[model samples]
Target: MQASNSPSLTRSQLATELGVSVFTLNQWAVSGKGPKAIRVGRQSVYRREDIDAYKATISSTESTPAPVSQPIGSYMMRLPEVLSLSGLSKSSIYAMSKAGEFPASVKLGSRAVGWPSHMVMQWLNDRMGNVA
Candidate 1:
């Protein structure tokens, strides 16, 4: 079930809530792994429900004394974080992008590139649904 108290979160906030380093989140985005995020124009946001679901899945698999209460969403990740989150290699991300199956990165500057963090998360969710 979704957490009613969970609130929309930015990539950085979600990363903190997940206890994952920002670097990790970026990898997930670039690699096309992790949870689905949303784009509000140039800003990115993650749904609290999605974060809670992901945490539940991960926490349930671990052999712990008890599960802790976690915020549904509270972080906002960058492209590098998504790449790490997804575990897809750079080439793989590029290939997926070329095929239009993965979220495409934008040219941030002359040499900088980035993807929508929320979109990367969505791709991950889609993959999970298909696998199930």
Candidate 2:
């Protein structure tokens, strides 16, 4: 990982890296259900560093995620990404979402869902520790 200070991704950019439809990401943002994002004149931009920090945290769980030598940012995640990251399932994720226990989904179009990658990760972190 290169030592830098700045976000490497726009909202659209991060979605592509994570392999999810853009509609999903937008939905997450609109609903206030994704990672902390900056609203730049009607656009959301996710910081690369934030994503990396989140990954580093999840990887250090008590169960200790399996060692995979991939750059943290290289693994952008979506709903399926969240399931795979925490070893949860689709139904479980939805249930949690409904209960407002997990990151909420943004509303994209009439029927689309997306979660903020960082928000999901941060939720995991707060779960792992007494985060403020």
Candidate 3:
């Protein structure tokens, strides 16, 4: 539990500060790898000190530089490829696409659709909090 006087950040604010999406933060929380959080009523909050310590740990352990941005050319990714890269179920992808949460697929032919490769890579980078 955090002290009552400590400053805290909401999940959304922390995600923005870390250059990642809220969904990514949620995944981290579930995996038990993110900064510790304190529950405040219905919300989860991160103490400023905890966030700072988490960043320090990451910076100290990471040896490689951040990933570069996706290449300039556009390429299409079929469903199987998308699933492999994203680790999301086909239904989740379609549901997220329909809800405008995930990138929409492009129509390749009468019955085929594919996602842009660059977009998928960008999304993955964003989720990994790798700014490029």
Of 2 and 3, the candidate ranking higher by lDDT:
3
Off by over 4 Å in 2: 1-77, 130-132
Give TM per candidate.
0.41, 0.37, 0.45
Look at candidate 2 and tell me the lDDT of residue 18: 59
Over the stretch 1-132, how does candidate 1's per-residue lDDT look in tens digits?
Answer: 123355887788878777798788778777766667778898667788777787787778768577634346623455578679899888898899999989887677887787766677788999999999
What is candidate 1's CA lDDT for residue 70? 30
**Which sections of candidate 3 miss by over 4 Å?**
1-6, 65-132
Tell how far residue 131 is off in model 2, in angstroms.
12
Over the stretch 33-65, how does candidate 3's per-residue lDDT look in tens digits? Answer: 888988899999999999999999998998987
- Best lDDT goes to which candidate? 3
Query: What C-alpha lDDT, on a 0 to 100 scale, does residue 13 get in candidate 2?
Result: 71
Kindly give the stretch of ten consecutive residues in candidate 1 with the minimal lDDT sum.
Answer: 68-77
**In the order shown, what is each candidate's alpha-carbon RMSD?**
18.5, 16.6, 14.0
lDDT of all predictions: 0.75, 0.69, 0.87
